[model samples]
Target: MATPRSRGPELEHDVGRTPSLGYEPAGSYGSVRYLEHGFPNPLVRWHYHEEYELHLIVATRGKVFVGDYIGQFEPGHLVLTGPRLPHNWISTDVPEPGVALRDMVLQFGDAPLRQAAALIPELAEALPLLERARHGVEFFGLSEAARERFGRVRAAHGLQRLAEFATLLDLLVRCNDYRLLSTVQLQSFDDDAALAHISGIVDYLIEHYSESFSMAELAQRSGMTESSFSRNFRRATGNSYTDFVNHLRINKACQLLMETDRYITNVCYDVGFNNVANFNRRFLQIKGMTPKEFRRQAEARFGSAA
Candidate 1:
């Protein structure tokens, strides 16, 4: 269990149509590329690439940002992000010397797999998993196995590496303890300008969820009328303006409840809710539990720092 910190200026720059990283692996490995990198490196940033990424965190706990999804991640946090999906992981509890091996990644293009799936029925089994990855997928109870498979993939070459990669995919495809992370599929956005605007707004709201504001104010700031903003916002985030804001506030309340020793009423107000009843209602609606219940469960699972 990891605690979250406020987004800093570095994180603000990471929002909105993030810079794309060019990954052209040249080797005998063919379609699949395996990579491992440490923290505090240039490669660790808010970025996107054209290939699907199977990411496994091997060390350190932090907050993970994928599209509009914000959550805590620790070692053994496994996620698969689809092509062009923006993502970043920021570690808040770094030692003075920093971690040397924080991530293990496998990158591959969909075109090769889809093309092969047309010829090989066995490969086609992975198509749905890739499709679900468009919104990002987090796999649970597979970290140790995934780490072993990743090692096998990294050690093999040519068709052998491809086979190892397919085996890893097979494991993920069959796993039922997985959750889709992002509510909206960013690739579904046809308008680049609208995507950028909505992304910026989302970043602002994530950072300032405790502050009070209205959709009308945000609409005006974006230079769009209320009606136009409403339509575009829903299209971009898959939630109405009010629902989106409430989601952010509830998410923050969850973090507070898990990591801090605050009263339920104080936690509610701290996360922008004016009333305890409304906060409790939204918490149950979004998280499927009351704040007190959530705190108790989190403490039992992770042993609260407070």
Candidate 2:
């Protein structure tokens, strides 16, 4: 990991790791669309991007994760995150009757945006917003005007997009009410070798559910001693090595239960659980439902065919 402090101007990470990924640096405007979807899953898997990101949640309530900080989210959230900061959005309150989940995301690569800050001292002042946005950059005094200014981003034109993004960033800088998610600069998740090791560990657990794996083995794969690897992995993702791998397993198990034609026993085995009984227990602990029950509810919510 190229050292990442929790709070500072040095926050930047690679974009290849993100799930809801999209970029348009090759275009004339070099602007990109930031979007979030309701399908596949309600959670945006924890990941980081290389681009400077400014997210404005257009609707609903949720929690934002930047590094280690978490906060109740509401509409009109205007956040600016520095490059490579790890973050994600999780909806806490689904929408009301007849309403769909309201979400939005915007991404911008550093290429076209190369000298955007150098050209504007105002943008430079907003660098703190990037640091603050790691743990979600909670907004207290900026919401009203930010909410008003953010609507301009949908202008559907190049110059308009730039102007709206500029407006959004400016609003965040002058706002007095906000806090950072992590205390250190967050560009730590950018190392390709480290990420490769992390990704391998994640993929390994996902493929082998019922088997037992140890942190030592994971560290060996990453070419680090157990303790050093543990510390760095946690620092990189705000998740302990074992806990993150467990979460990954649990997540995969839930997905299988929710969307598959396989039986519960089969699903458990398919997800790497040798102990079906234990699998049930852990699934309930994390998902609040047994495999059969989860499948039933998932059918009702998204359609059995889903």
Which candidate should be chosen as best, given TM-score against the real structure? 1
TM-score of each: 0.57, 0.48
Q: In terms of lDDT, which candidate is strongest? A: 1
lDDT of each: 0.78, 0.58
Candidate 2 residue spans exceeding 4 A from truth:
1-146, 155-157, 169-200, 203-212, 300-306
**RMSD in Å for model 2:** 11.8
Residue 222, candidate 2: alpha-carbon lDDT: 76
What tens digits encode model 1's per-residue C-alpha lDDT throughout 1-306? 234443221322222322233232454458887777777666766666788989999998877767645578999999999987767777767798888889888988999999999999998989989888987999999999999999999889877988899899999999999988855333247887987887788888888889999999998888788998888899887889999898888877766764567777888898899988999999888877788877665543222231
lDDT of 2: 0.58
Candidate 1, residue 217: how far the Cα is off, in Å: 29
